[model samples]
Target: MTTLRALTPADASGIRRIYSGAAVTYLMRPEMTASEAEAYVARVIEWSRAAPVAQYVLGVDVAGDLVGVVKLGRRPAGHGRVSYVLREDVWGRGYATAAVERLAAYAFTAAALESLGAKHHPDNPASGRVLTKAGFTCLGADGGFVHYWLDRDGRRESSGQHREGPGVSPGRTRCPRGRSSR
Candidate 1:
């Protein structure tokens, strides 16, 4: 089973490795280019040491293997966004959904955060499903992207009146292989 733990300097190398692997396969727009990936890794290591008040970054280790990550980012004005990425090989096995759910629960209970949000490229239906399963509501579309948010109560609240996107519908009722439906 995958578990989240406080990130430490010892985990940096593994985290960097995961970041480098993801840089090549993930479609996140803000991800660093190949040449800049190393530099970004170094920056994350530095940032990890500062102990920022509202940012909760964790290493997602599954049975001793660092498989992914989940981070809670707080902007200058206290707004927050939670993001996650699983190793490409583990895609579609429900790791992303489990990580997002665990992160949301931690954010609301441990961090005492006001709100958490994320944006999915409209083309990434898998990512949309993960966010929706974690109880995020699609607020609307902007620049052809879908925006979602989860409030402090662990329920979704839309920022504006909008029609449901693909994620708004209830997802599969059956659990994925090797897991039980809750």
Candidate 2:
């Protein structure tokens, strides 16, 4: 089973292992070295510690092994940003969706956040699907990526007229393994 926990310095190697060139390119550009990856996690850990609300980063732990991360980013004007990354091998396991959902639950209630935002490259619709399953509604594309947002009380729409896109329907979501998000 996958569990969510606070990220620590010990998660460096596991994180280093997952943030491959292919994986990072989907979200970021740099192909990080082991030391760089360690430093990145360390920095996030430090930020989490310094935050008034401990809603910064969390590790996705499966059977005591770290496989991925979920982060609640502090955006300007009180909105939050939600993001996650998993090991490439674990891409289709529903882990990212579950982790994001876990973080959203915490952010909406315990952290007292008003709204959370996310974005994905237009080519990476899998991530959009994950965001949708985790309660984000697409806000169309900007700068080669599609944006999404989820507000408290389960609302995820930018306008009342538009509901879903392509083949998506309201309240309908597909898991990473191609199963329904039921």
Candidate 3:
């Protein structure tokens, strides 16, 4: 089972492991050291506490282990952007797709977002597949990345057979506008 929840201080180590891998960070950012990952988790926790929260840095829990993170950043005009990173060991599984699906549901239903956008490095076609499986339509390549979009109506239209995964937990909070690290 996969669940999304607020990041706790305890999650820093697992987060560190996820960010420290070159395979995982290749298309994201530089590999983070333990201290850097701790600092990043601290920043994310603070963002969650902000008034009219602009960002959600939720820990992706698989079974009971923190395996990755999925972020939703609110943008202007009721639109938002979503991105994620998972442990290399978890790659090829459907966790990323499931996590994205749950996050989109929360964006449209709880955050009241009209649309969500995402982009992936062209070299990372797996990421593109994940976005497509989650209901985002391809918006073509731009700025060296393949862009994608999913509006409220589009999500609804494509999610006709959507079913909540067992034990899935979507975090509760509003998101804000910002750039995502993934």
**What CA RMSD would you report for each candidate?**
7.2, 5.9, 10.3
What is each predicted model's overall lDDT from 0 to 1? Answer: 0.64, 0.74, 0.76
The candidate that wins on TM-score is 3
Clashes (N, CA, C under 3 Å) per candidate: 0, 0, 4
Q: Candidate 1: where are CA atoms >4 Å away?
A: 8-13, 20-52, 76-78, 158-182
lDDT of 3 by residue, 126-181 (tens): 88888888887655555566666777886532332222211112331111112111
TM-score of each: 0.70, 0.82, 0.83
Model 3 residue runs over 4 Å out of place are: 155-182
lDDT (tens digit, per residue) of candidate 2 on 1-182: 77889878877888887787467878766666889978988888788768485458889988898888888876655568887888888888888888999989888787788778787766777898889888787665655566677777787654543423323344433223331222
Top lDDT hit: 3
Where is the poorest 10-residue window by lDDT in model 3? Answer: 172-181
Q: After superposition, how far is residue 114 of candidate 3 from its true place, in Å?
A: 0.2
In model 3, pairs of residues that clash are: 54-175, 54-176, 55-176, 74-176
